[model samples]
Target: MTVASKDVGMMTMIENGNEVKRTCCSSNSGCGSSEILVEYAGNEKWIQGVINTPKGVVPVVSTQLNFSDILGSWKARWGVNRMNYKINPGLYAVGTPDNESPVLVTANYKSTFDSLRKELADINTWILVLDTKGINVWCAAGKGTFGTKELLTRISCTKLHEIVTQRTLILPQLGAPGLSAHEASRQTGFQVVYGPVRAKDIKEFIRRDMTATPEMRTVKFTTYDRLVLTPIELVEAIKVSIIAFGILFLLNLIVTIPFGLDDFYAYVGALIIGCVITPVLLPWIPGRAFAWKGWLLGFIWAVVVNLINGWPQLPSYSLVRAIGYLLVLSSISSFYAMNFTGASTYTSSSGVIKEMKIAVPIIIITVSLGMLLILLNSFMGI
Candidate 1:
């Protein structure tokens, strides 16, 4: 069989005792394709047989990262191609592996799968991907999709015990949140092993006799990692255009001149400040809670807006409109910050609940007051 796409090219041949590979050559002798001959188990089933009724077709057991996978990763960052960007939830072989090869388990999220397989390019292993609904391991564990139940279920469904000689299964460290190691061993009879925090360290972990270094045990969210998430947040904020457009329409009706664009710009600016800038600059921003950090940024931006509008005096615009912008814009920023607590690290469920109880009520009150003031100024001809 021959497989070709814009990003990848490959040919496959499965045969008897002799190694099988197709040498790709054009009419000319300019280009030559090297034959990759892997000696696989004759008793083992076809590479495709591992799929069963899995959602995705198994890509001919490869460790090389495809250009298409990198492209898919770019799309996932912007929240595009996120839902279907996943591998089939089942057992798979990285290269030709005997029963003694180590078994590694991971989430079906394509990026995570690619990262793991890419690091183990030279090492032959069994990869058992769980159905995490396309979420990364950490988030999936938090949501319970990467829990002990699904792990045991997949193990049973795939008949893993019958395939591999060893009863040890290595899992990503992030998946520990929802998994009870003892409970899993008690039920499945397979020993659970938590591997390194990052895929890059997996090779080292295995080479050092399945031992993870202290550095590998720690999880760190760097600035770049934090920055990438802002794009998705900004895009998600755009989905609330209905309410924003409604408010803009009302503002257009109230003002005789073209103040609609000004108000709209201010609205969009608030979104940028809240969703994009707030999270990107989270560490530098002052305040323990996300709400206050957002509010501070919003208040500062509101002041800048006021200065642009001639802070001291206004001929046509009322004091209420000026005050209204300050209150409303700051509140919008604060709301975005409060909602973003889930995306940040070291935040507890009970702490988030505690913050929401206090922050939500205050945001509601401030926003309502700002809107009322703007309407009252419009009606009274201020």
Candidate 2:
């Protein structure tokens, strides 16, 4: 319980690291919930309800996130519906836990916190939610928001020593990047033990005495995982693509460029092929680099579009226009496809840098030459 929790009218029934509760109906400060609050112990303002145990009180929460929570999480994934969706950070008890109960640490991002807690529905444990300002553990760990300093600060603020007799803290494996076990143990006197990569595997980890299998240690970015991450990339990309396409269509009408509405529409089709199809068909796309994969698909798409429009029998400068469109579309496709490298597991930092070094100048030169050729044809009155 926090100092504020204690001030709401409860005295500590101190145990070997367990909570004591008292009713606060008489006082204004008390536990509350927008939904039904099962208990109103004045001190535990954060808990909606709790279960009493021989060692202390275990706050009761629904094992499942309601529709609202699920919807909010989904929206958050797309950077909408309040992207920083979060919950308060502090200590929470999963069930009636004794001093020997496991203590699990996690980021305060509501999605991660919810995932961690829900998986512990049948297990009695203590949860130490660290404040990461609504950022998920993996990203926060990279940003240092989930670092050792924050961990030590939270431990001190929660007075974790007074509540638990054990000296072991189970931390998520993803958070290890920001935390040093030696530093944490030295500062808090609690040995930091890295848990499995997924919360669902925690039970198996515990059953095996905190020993993780080889499978648990490996991180797999499967097709489904990559697929789920595509929506945000697609949505953000299309917003820009729409604006660019509209500008090109408007410009063609005003300037009578070699490219026309058909070309504009073709680019839109290319955008779809780049942002959506490329990601979905990543593994099958030829080439070791993402840029080449996208270019190959864009080139094929351009050919198909041209074939549908009478390839070899067209007006003067029509072939030039088609070539220009292909150049633009291929460049656009290559750029868009490469963006996914930052989101997926296929590319490392150095590899991405190397790919960019070779692809960027080519994209720029192709786009510039395509525009120059189209403008030359337009000026020639062809």
Best by lDDT: 1
Each prediction's TM-score versus the true structure: 0.81, 0.80
lDDT of 2 by residue, 202-258 (tens): 989999999999889777777777777777777788788778767766666757554
In model 1, which regions exceed 4 Å deviation?
1-60, 254-259, 313-316, 378-381
Question: For each predicted model, how many residue pairs clash, with residues at least 3 apart or on different chains?
Answer: 0, 1
Evaluate model 1: give its lDDT.
Answer: 0.73
Question: Which lDDT tens digits does candidate 1 get at residues 93-163?
Answer: 77666567788999978888888887887787888888787888999998898988888766765556766
Clashes of 2: 1
